[model samples]
Structures are given as structure tokens and as C-alpha cells.
Target chain A: MGQVVLKGINKFYDSVHAVKDVNLQIRDKEFVVFVGPSGCGKTTTLRMIAGLEAISSGDISIDGSVVNGLAPMDRDIAMVFQNYALYPHMSVYDNMAFGLKMRKFTRPEIDRRVRDAADILGIGELLKRKPRQLSGGQRQRVALGRAIVRHPRVFLFDEPLSNLDAKLRVQMRVELKKLHLRLGTTAIYVTHDQVEAMTLGDRVVVMKDGVVQQVGEPLELYNRPANKFVAGFIGSPTMNFATVTVTEANGSLIAENAGLRIRLPDGTARRLRGHIGHKVTLGVRPEDLTVAGAADPDHPCFDAVIEVVEQLGSEILLDMKVGQDVMVASVEPTVRVNVRDKLRLAMRPSSLHVFDVKTEEAI
Target chain B: MIEGAIWRKWAFFYLPMALFLLFLLFPFYWMVITSVRPDGELYRPWNSVNYNPFWTWNPTWDHVRYLFEETLFAAWLWNTMFIALVSTAISLVCGVFAGYALSRLNFPFAGSLGTGIFITYLVPQTLLFIPLAEIIRNYRLGDTPWSLILTYPTFLIPFCTWLMMGYFKAVPKELEECARIDGASRWQAMLYIVIPVAIPGILSAGIFAFTLSWNEFIYALVFLSSPEQKTVPVGVTSELIRGDVFFWGPLMAGALLGSIPVAIAYSFFVEHYVAGLTGSVKG
Candidate 1:
């Protein structure tokens, strides 16, 4: 019953077009996350769905009913803001009961729901404490409790975990996933944190500059990003990009730059045949590049001078210079590496991504 | 607070703080002493036998009795309280709504309208009262409590509205939005979420409005002539002084008694008042 669909949604604030022609279909009990950098219109789209921001054009339908001009109260959705937005004057019990009271529920029913939500959030002991008296994580739980007491059709979260400390954010993230699983409510979450987006969403929507770059499941996006921006934004330590001219040699494509030359993978070369003799952007994730062993001649290997080695315990990240371009390679922690050392790095053939320079789209 | 040597702390903080406290409290001390001093001692020459100007050995309550029993001081106190309360209530209702609208709502000419209201406040009462006097006379409310009650909001509304607008702006708009999405209409959201969160601001504004109207002098002097209809500032000054003869003891007594309510109000809500001025809304 919680199917939400947005059709050609657009938003404009005076002369600036904030969101442009976004179309999305969210299934019942689906967790969809919209993720992008700041000013990418992700939060704006979430607000539009919550009915807090009016859409300039197109329609939004919740459970097959068009809700263009409907008030937020009529839309039957709840939003948890990044700052928690807890009513400071109210105790936790009252804060959770406010939504039920506003809807004219019986006092006993409201109390039952409030207590139920508090128990679910493990905050029953804090029922009488005001929001200011609680810690940030507790206040966040109260915000969630407030949203859950109403049993709204869809839940909108606008970076709800951004305010918590790192450990608390990870903990709350797991709790949020568990909560969504238990409630099975269709939820639309917005955040600029890619890790949160990947871990929590059933389908992640990547956006940039008010445009939807790609929408797919987490692994699909990681394996095959639709564009250069998605490829660069979805992974941590960011994907390394280098501009290289493509040339045909013996019916195979070779990507060459001023400092290094590498053969394109067979699958990538087939699609990039038309891009021969044209300069294209080559993208490779940090994890895909490792120290080249003597037996790794079949893979595309390049010489790079290590500039900095960051030991992150699990792996060592080597910041290296390949000609004029700088790239990062995540090597095994056991491998000995030092700054100013010359290392040969080989990238997995199937992991190479080539994008058209003009369109910034994968070729 | 100054952190370093004792001499630096004394020079930079303690000395200045002591001077400020003395300067601020000196007037209240003078008022209290003059109100309780006997007439014989108050008017004594500086060269009199064992003359002491600062300390009065013979303190009396006769001036307080004279003020309460002989003059219309009680009536004036009642009149001022009624007018200040009524006017503050009216202006608070109007100010809260107006401030919320101006700060939160998107409307045509909202910016210019706010500026216009502020400009109205900027017009000093010394000059604006001339036209206000005409309006009062035309409405036939002259020399009545209604006259002051109605006219006080002329300035009080703008003051309250301005203070309230800044307060409402400091409140995060997401609270109301979340309330709206949680099954409350806009008005409900404002009433349940916004207004409650803004209690500190409202209290500070209420205290300021009450003080302004209570101590108001020019409008009370020009509009209220009868001793029974006057407020404290006007009634005390007008009734206690005779032609070429000032009744200093009873005058000081009336002033001292008249200021007690405002003092009590400030002390009662001083914490909230300071918080409102600082304007911090923590989540």
C-alpha cells in the first residue's frame, strides 16, 4: 500500500531550476535513497515528496492517488530531519504522541502507540525526559519514534544520521535498516554520504547538478556506473581518472598518454572502437589497481612513483604519480612500500572503465 | 575570566565591574533613602548641627501613608496595571502572529512591509503623539484607561513584532515542516511546535512591552489629565508637586512604590530574558 511514484517532477526557485524532470517508481516496502554532493537537489526532491516543497511541474502519486495539491497532513507521510527537529518543550512521550493527538486518536490509543514505539527504540526509560536532556543519539531515536507512532505510509529521512558521531552513525544506520525491515514502509532517504547510501538503500539514485546520473542497486552501480560522475562518486578513495588518447593497433584499442601506455580490456575495447584516435577519460577504482607481479604481464600495467603511503591497517593506500596524473592504489598491508619508490601497478582488465570526454558518459 | 595575573584581572575586570554595579544601583539607593527619610531631616541645611546627608537616623513611613491615603496613588497604580496588562496582551497576540508571518511565510511585499512597520516605530513619540492626540480626541477616548490601552500598542506592536520576528527566524523551520508532515496543519504546527518553542522569546517580549507601557510618560501626560486616570509616571509627578513647592518625600515614595512591579517582573524572568537576547535554539 505504500507505493510511491514521481512522474517528471521538476522544481524551480525563481530563476534557478533546482530539480529537473525526475521520474522515479518506488515499490511498496522499498528503501530508496537519493545521494549526491551538496546543492545536487537531493534534499529538495525529498522535501517535494514530503509535500513540504511544492513541485513546479509534474505529479506525485502515493498508493495510486495523485497528491499534487494535497497538504502534508493529507499526504500521510512523516519526515525525520537531520537535526532531529524534536520539540524541545515536550517530553519524549508527549513528542511521540503529538502526531497521534493531532490526528484525533483516542488518548489510550495514543499512549499505547507511544509506549510501543518507545519500547521498539529502547527509549522507554527516557519517556519523561525532555529532548534537550537527551544525547544526540537518543534525540534521533525520539525523532524516529515520533515518526513511527503514526504508522505513516512513507517515511522521509533527510540525512538523519549526519549529526551523530561516527560510531553512533554506524549504529543508528543498522538500527534504521532493522526498523525499516520490521515496518516494511516505503522510505525515501536523502544523503550526501555515499557509504550510507550504498549500505541502506535497496536502490540508490545518484544525482549531480540537478540531474539524475544513474539509478540502480548498490552492486550494479558499483560494477557498471552509468557515467563518469557516478563512477567517481559511488566508491570511497574515489576512482582515479586519466585522460588518454585511444589508438587502434592490430585490431585492438590501446590507450596511451604522455607517461604510460596500456591495452584496453577486450570487452571495453569492443564498445570503444568508435572512440579510436579520440581522447577519452579512463577510470579505475583504487582497489582494482594493485602491485604488479612478474606474472601480471597480461594485465594493463603502468609505472608510477609513490608519493605518499597511507597505512589504514587493513590495506595500504599508495598515492602515486603516473606522468602528470595522480592515482591512488590500495595495496595489501603486507606489501612493503615507501614514498619516492617506483612501483609497477597492474589494473584488472575487466575493471577498466572508459568514458566519452565530451558527454562524460561511459563508452 | 581574564586568566592571567591577579593585577591584570583586577585592572581589566574587577575594577570596571565594581564601577558599573555602583553606577547602576546608586539611583535605587537614593530613591529608597529619600522615600523613608523624615521631612525634618530631608530639608535640613548642609551646615545644620551634626548634619548628615547620606544617612538618616530618623526614618519614617509618613510619606508612604500620605501617598497612599491622601493622593490618587492607589488608583493610578491600578490604572497603570490594567492598561499595561491589557495592552501587552493585545500586542502580544498581534505581534506573535505578525512576526511569524513576516519571518516564515512567503508573501508579496513581506520585506517592505516589515521595514515599513520598523519605520513606524522609529517615529519618536514626541512628534507622533501630536497626530495620535487628534485620533484619541476624535474617538472620544481621552483621559480614560482605554485611551492609553489602545494607544500604547501603536508603539508596542512594532517593538514586539520586531523582537518576535528575530526570535521566530532563529527557530529552525524544519521543526514546523516535520510537524506538518506528521499530520498537523500549518496552524496546528505553529501553535503546537513553533509557539511553544518560542516561549523564551515571547516572555522576553512580554516583559519588555510591560516595562515600556508601565514607564511610558509623554503619552500618559498628554492624554490622561485627571489624577485618577493617570499612570504612575504621570500621576506621581503631577499630584505631588504644588506651585513652586515640590513634595520631595512623598514624590520619592510614590516613585519607589511604582517601580516595584517592573523590578519584580525583570527579576522573575531574567534567565529567559538573557536566553532570548542570546538567541540560541539547540536541537
Candidate 2:
């Protein structure tokens, strides 16, 4: 039973507080991912949980026992590093068998485990080759094999697939998910890629500036971000944000700017009831903004001129100008649009997001 | 690999290479020729007819024979080899540990401490031998193999440590971190992952340390006074020359023979040495 918990864990590097007061509880057989921009403390938090980095305060417990002062070896975990970290001098078999050898496994047991892992990774025939002789994907597989051979209680991955090319990254991501399911071991993955975190994680933790912003399932974080940072960080083509003032008129709410006005839906207006006459940050995802038609006169429509048209085969993304700001809108491929042409775009009322400008928190 | 024309190849690659080789190897050629030239030809004055100083005729082993039989050249060679190897071993052991610590561990003052160790390496050996001589005499290790062996690391360790620190820094820290999470202790991770990956760096450092102690002159001259204890550099210069009379033949023979070990060492690990110098730990 692999269960890892971090209680108010903090890491300080001299005067710089790198990871500040992180608390998490990873359940048995759960796949959790920590994702953030560069220097956002995701990797630092992963290293702290792996016991590679010391916690300046608080405790980390693995399997209900506090491992704060324990060595990484005593923690019973295996990690796949971003560079794979395959032992260059050792053969693939030796690299896979190293942990077993360290634990004093018998020759037969070590052989069995190594061969099983190699077969599982489809690298059985490449066991005799050194790490330098293997391709990048093969090295990645061998790295994975090395971690699996130990059968440790917890597996830590620090941007393992970020080294692979695009197509290979997707293939390996699927394989990693399958491997986790087959092994049924608790795994903690860290990456800067939102797509990787969304696809691979059972639960995703989004961090920014050394603080945990939000943690939830992929769709939850995408559909309901906790703050402006989470809204922008967890989606592709990213959510477009604009500062609009909430003004009460005609017994309803109208979010207004210089060249844009949208009537806030009743549900959204209720949340902004006390914040009238104050400015709020309006967030709209690219896919949530659709082309308005004459029949949609009741919808909140705004005028925008298409600046750049990007046809991505499956969908067409329009970079359009609204007042002084540019926002991207993902539309159906069948919709005909061109640069410098004016269009009326309507935002999905139920999907609209409003954040307090001061706190940048969802209103 | 120079492209375009044949003239460009010769101008850019071959001709310059040939000249550089000649410039580099001329000293060894002179050493080899002078050691073998007969005494009649050796002092034959450059003004003599049929001079041809570059080529020698009627070669003899008399200089080599005298170098071995008359002077304590064999004992000096043995002494030089023993002192160099022992001191290099001691320095490498300490250096590898010190270098790994300075580069990898996040101890207090690690940055300044590394700079401190490197600063010590920059101090000229000429100045260090005086204070060292006093310590050698107080400990009564003077004129013995231990005198040079123990004192050589004083300079060698810092040199080795500095070289190794730069090398260790190039090795990815992820390798050790991965190994530690694989259930290996910190020491095991270093042994299994870091040191093995750093073999080329270690060889280059060892080669550098070996050559430094092998060719060290001032310390050997000041510390060792006996013909039996004197290394090749000190013994050959002091014993082969007497006042105004310079034994050119034996002196050249000693020079030629003394450099063979270092040459062999360089050629033996040339690939790893180059890799070490260039920082081969890419992964």
C-alpha cells in the first residue's frame, strides 16, 4: 500500500523560500501530477517528496511512517528523471538489475525481474547494449524498465517524457498510463506541460510562484479554474482575459469597456452583486467564443475584426481584435472567415468567467 | 576535412599540420640524436666540414651506458616513478572526494570553498617549497622517498581537485538523484552512477596529476639531496654536470630516457584524456 503525505512541507534555500508550505496526501494507486511554469517549484516539491531535497519544516511520511530524516534508499521509491539518467557505463540489463543487486536479491530473482521488465518495456533484445548505443526512446524505455524492476512502493517521475519528440511523447504518455494501471502503484509526476498533466494525471496540481494554486481532476481544473492564473495555465490556446467594468443598468448587469459590452448572465451577475461599479477581469476560452447569428440576438455579442486566420485542419482559430485587445477564438472549420473582415462573436453565457481585478480570483 | 580545392586542403589543414608537428617534435628529435651521437662528432665544432648537424653518423651507446653504469640514473628513474605514482594515487583519492564534495554537496561556503581551493592551486610552487622544506626537516622526511611523496600532493591535490570539480559539475545531477531514489544510498549513487560516468574526467585528472608530479623540478631539487633519492629531473641536471664541464652526451641521454614514461602515459589514455578535457558527460 503506497500512500505518501506531505504536511506543511517547506523548503528554503538561504533567504529564498523556494517551496512554501505545501501539503498533499497521495492515495494508494493514485496518479498525481504537479505542473507549473519554469521555476514554479513543481520539481522542487517532487524532489522533497522523493527525499532528495530536505524539507526545511514539517514532515513527509510514506506508508504512514515519517520519512523526514530518512535517506532516499530507506524511502523505497524509484524515480525516472527528465534525462532518463541511465547509467552510461552499464548494460541495459545491469542498469535494470542495479537496485535488485543493491537489495541483495538472488541471482535468479534478479534475472527474472530484469527479464520481465525488459520484456514489459519491449527492450528484451537490447539488454546487452550500453545506454549510449540506444536511441532516445529506447533509453527512455530502459529507464522505465530500471524503475519497474525494483517494484518499489512509490514511483516518482520528474518530467520523464519531456525529452522525447512530440509523437513519441504521446506514445510514451499512453504507455506510462498503462504501466501505472498495470502496476497499481502510487506515482507522482511533475511537468511544465499542461497537456501532459491533463492527459496523464488522475489529479493535477497547478502551481505558480511557489504556491499551489489549485488541485483537481483535469476537466475540473479546465472547466472551473480557481483563479486567473489557473484559468490561463490549464488550457491550450489559453483563455483570453480582458479587464471590464461591471456597471448596473436596466435592472441587470453589463460588463463594459471602451468597444465591448456584454450583459452578464443571471448566475454570473449574482456573484458580482456587491462588486458593481468595480472593474472585473473577464475570461473566455477560445472554444467558448462562437460566431453569433441573427437568431442569437439575445446573446451577448461583441464586434471584432479577424486579424489572423489559423486553420489547424480539425478547427480554425481566429486571432481577432476587440477594442485594443486581441483574443483567440476557436471556431468550426466550416465557418468562412478572413483577415481584416468584421465579425460578431458571442460568448457562451454559462461558460463565462469573471474574476475580481484586485485578487484575480474567480468572482 | 577542409572543403573546396586541393590547395585549400593543403593550406588550411595539411601544410600547417606538418609545420606544427615539426615544431612540436623537434625537441625530441634533438634529444634522440644528441644522446646517440659519438663523442668525436659531438664536439666536432659547427665550423667543421661535412657538419650536417641534423644527422648523426657512427652512433654509440656509450652515453646511455655511462648514464646507467656511472651515474645513479636507474635508481633515479625508480625513485621518480615511485614518488610520482604514490603521490598521484594519494592526491587522486583526496582530490576525487574533495572535488565531488565541492561540486555536488550544498554545504555552507561551498562556492567560496571551491574558489578557495582553486586559489590555492594558483599559488606558485616556487614559493610553497620554502615553508614546506621547514616542515620536511622538522618531520625529518628530507632526502627520503617520503619527502617527495608526501610533499608532492600539497600542490597535486589542489590541481587534481580543481580539475575534478569542473568535470563533476558537467555530469548531470539527475543521474545521482535517480540512483538515490532507486534505493541506493548517497555513497552508492556516487560510486555506481557519478564516478563511473566521470571516468574520463578522472583519467584526465589522474594523467595531469601524474605528469605534474613526474616533471616537478623545484621541490625535488630542494627536498631531495642524495643521488639515490633524487628524481630523474634533479639527478640528471645535478650529477651529469660538474662545474664548467657539461656532460652533453649523458645529459641528453638522461633527458631522452626520463621523458619516455610521461609520453607513454599520454599516448595510452589519449582518447579518455581528450574526452576529459572536453567534458564528455553530456547526458
Candidate 3:
């Protein structure tokens, strides 16, 4: 029943506070991913959970028991490091069997489990080869095979896929999800890639500067971000942000800057009623924008000049100049857009996001 | 290898290489020739007709025979072999453990401790032998092989430790971390995973420690007083040359024979030695 809970987790490296007040409850068989920019304490938190790092003042319980003082071996967990960390001198079979051997399993049982994990990872034929003889992808499989042979209560992944090439990384991501489903083991994965976190995690934890910004399902994080940082971090092409002043007119609120005068929708206006006549930040996602039609008068329309056009086959990305701010619009591939062309774009009312200027938190 | 004219290749690479090889091998060539040369040919004046100092057509086994018969050369060989092997084994065990701990563990003052150990290696043996001789006399180990065996590690352990520290540092820390996470205790992880991965480094350190003790002169010469207890360097030098008259033949013969074991050891583990020196830890 691998349920892991961390309470009041704090880490200090001498005087540098690497991780601050992290509390998380990870349920059985759940694949949770902690993601953020470099030095955001995601890896530190994972290491703490693995019992690899000492907790300054907190409790980490695994399988309903406090493991704060236990060694990593007693934690009954396996980890896949970024570099694979395969034993250079040992063959693949030996590498996979090491953990089982350490745990004092019988020789035949160790062999059977090693081969089973090898077969699962499609590395049975590579059992006799050393790590130096295997390709990057094959070595990665061996590392995974080594971890799976133990049947540990929890699996810790520290940017395991970051070392693979782009094509291989995508391929392994699907395999990892499938492996989690097959084993039904609790896993905590850490990475800096937002897409990986969004795709693989049952619940994604977004962090910034040693603090967790938000924790939710992938779509929830994308749809309703807690702060401007989450909104900008969780999506590709980055949500465009403009520091605009909110003004009330005609019993509504309008957020406007040097180039944008967007009439806030009722939902956004009601939330911003107290925010009116104050400095606020306006946020809009690229995919929520489309070419405005004459009949769509209810939609908020704004004028922008296309500075560059990127044809991505599946979609056309227009880098547009909106007043004094630059924004990216992921438009339909069929749209015939050119550089320096003035176009009117509309924002879906429900998709508009407003954040506080000072706190950078969503309003 | 110079990618240009033929003359450039010859001048830049081949000529210099040939000169370097000649310079390096000339001493060994002289030793071998002198050891085998007849007593008359060696004693002949250089200005005499057909001096032929480089090559001796009349080669005899008299020098080698005298070396074995007239001196305690066999006993010296046995003493040197036993002392070098035991001391090297002792130093290797201490070095590997000290190096692994200093490089990997998170103990307080680990960095300073490592530096301090390395600084011990820098102390000259010449000065160290004076105090060591006093200790040897007090322990009543003055004329025994134990004196040299016990004292050799003073320098050898530090040398081996310093060499091993650099090698252990090159090994990635993730391998041990993964092993620990895989169920091995810290000590088990070191023994099974880290030590095995560092075999090349160990071999290199062992070979160096072995050679260092084998060729060590100051401590061996000072500590061993008995003719039978003396090592090769001391035995060959003291017993062979009777006061002012030097036994060049047996001395050369002894030098030539003394180097064979170290040469064989080097050739045996040449690949690992090179790899260890390069200190590359493949991920």
C-alpha cells in the first residue's frame, strides 16, 4: 500500500535554504511529478523522500510508518538517476540482480526476477553486455530494469528521461506511463520539463524558488493557474502577460495598456470589481486567440501587427506586436498570415486570466 | 603524423622520436652489455685499438655467476620481494579505504582532511628516515625485514592514498547512491559497487606502491644492518664494491636483474595502468 506523506519538509545546505515547508501526500499507485526551473528544490524533495538526504525538521512517512531516520535501504524504494548509473564493470544481468542479491534473495529467484525485468524492458538479449557496450537508450532500459527487479514500494525518478534524445525521450515517456499502469506502484518523478509533468503526472506540483506554486491535475493547472508564474510556466509558447491599468466604464471593467484595450468579460469583471482603478496584470494564452470575425462582437477584439510568421505544418504561430508588448498566437494552419500584416484577434471570454500586479497571483 | 611534406614528418615526428627512444633506452643497453662483457674487454683502455665499448663480442656469465655466489644476492632478492609485496598490500588496503572515505563521505572537515593527507605525502623521505631510524632502534626492529616493511608505508600509504583519492573522485557519486537506494548499506555499496568499479585505480595504486617500495633506498638501507637482511639496492652496492674497487660487472648484472620484476608487472597491467592514470569514469 505505498502511501508516502511528507510534512513540513525543510532542507538547509549550511546557510542556503534549498527547500522550504513542503507538504505533500502521495497516494498508492499515483504518479506524481514535481517540476520547476533549475534550483527549485524538486530534486532535493525527491532525495529527501528517498531517505538519501537528511530532513532538517520534518517527517517523511512511507507505508503509514515514519521513515524520517531510516536509511535509504530501509525505505524499500528504488530510484532511476539521470545518468542511469549502471555498474560499469558488471554485465546487464548482474546489474539488474545486484539489488535482489543485496536483499538476500535466493540465487534462482534473483535470476528469475532479473530476467523478468529484462524481458519487460526488452533487454533480455543485452544481459551479457556491459554498460559501455550499450547505446544510450539501451542503457536507460537497463537502469529501469535494475529498479523494477526489486518490486519496491515506491519508485523515485530524478529526471530519468532528461538524458535521452528528443525522439527517445518521447518514446520512453509512453513506456513509463504504461509501466506505471502495469505495476500500479507509487512513483514520484522530478523534472524541469513542463510537458513531461503534464503528460505523465496524475497530479502535477509546480514549484518556484523552493516554494510550491500550485498542485493539481495537468488540465487543472493549465486551465486555472494559481499565479502568473504557473500560467507562464505550465504552457508552451508561454501565456502572454501585459501590465495594464484597470478602468471602470459603463458598469464594466476594461484592462488596457499601450496597445491593448480589452473589455473584461462579466466573470473577469466581477472578480476585478475591487481591482478597478488599480494597476493589474493581464494574461492571455496563445491558443485561446483566433482571427476575429465581424459577427463575433461579443468577443473581446484587439489589433496586432504580425512581426514574424512560423509555419509549423500543424499550426501557424504568429509573433504579433500588441501595443508595446509582444504576444504569440497559435492560429490555424490554414490561416494565410504574413509578416507586418495588421490583424484583429479575439479572446475567448472564459479563457481570460487576470493577475495581481504586485503579488503576481491570479485574481 | 605531421600532415605536410615527407621531410616535415621526418623532422617533426620520426627524428625526435628516435632520439627520445635512444636517450631513454641507452642506460639499459649499457647495463646489459656491461654485465655480459668479458673482464678484459671492460678493463681495456678506451684509446686502445678497437675499443668497441658499445658491443662486446666475447660475452661471459662470470658477472652473473659472481653476483649469485659471492654475495647475499639471493637473500636480498627474497627480502626485497617479501617487503615490497607486504608493504604494498598494507598500503593498498589503507589507501583504498581512506581515499573512498575522503572523496565520498560528508564528514566535517573532509576537504581539509584530504588536503592534510596529501600534504603528508609531500614530506621528503630523506628527512623522515632520521626520526624513523630512532623509532626502529627503540622497537628493536633495526636489522629485521619488519623494520623496512613497517616504515615503507609512511610514504607509500600517502602516495597510494593521494593517487587513489583522485581516481575515486572521478567515479560518479550517482552509482553509489543508486546502489544504496537499491538496498545495499553504505559499506556494502562501497565494497560491492564502488570498489569493483575502481579496480583500475586500485591496480594502478597497487602497482605504484609496489614499485615504490621495491626501489626504496633510504629506509631500506638505514633500517637493515645485517648482510642477509639487506634489500637489493643496499646488498648490491655495499657487498659488491670492496672499498675503492667497484665491481662494475656484478653491479650492472644486479641492476639489470633487479628491474625485471617491475618491468614484468608494468607489462602485465599496462592497459589498466593507462586507464587508471587517465582517470576516466565512463557513465
Residue pairs clashing, model 3:
A259-A323
Superposed Cα RMSD, model 3? 1.0
Q: Each prediction's DockQ?
A: 0.86, 0.70, 0.90
Residues A297-346, candidate 2, lDDT per residue (tens digit)? 66788999999999999999999999978899999999998899999998
Candidate 3 accuracy as lDDT:
0.93
Interface RMSD (C-alpha) of each candidate? 0.8, 1.2, 0.7
Candidate 1 chain B worst ten-residue window by lDDT: B274-283
Candidate 1's C-alpha lDDT? 0.93
Error of 1 at B12 (Å): 3.1
Return the TM-score for chain B, candidate 3: 0.98
Clashes of 1: 0
Which is the leading candidate under DockQ?
A: 3
Cα error, candidate 2, residue B283 (Å): 2.2
Where model 1 places Cα greater than 4 Å from the true spot, the runs are: A294-296
lDDT of 3 at B266: 97
For candidate 1, chain B by itself scores a TM value of 0.98
RMSD of each: 1.3, 2.0, 1.0
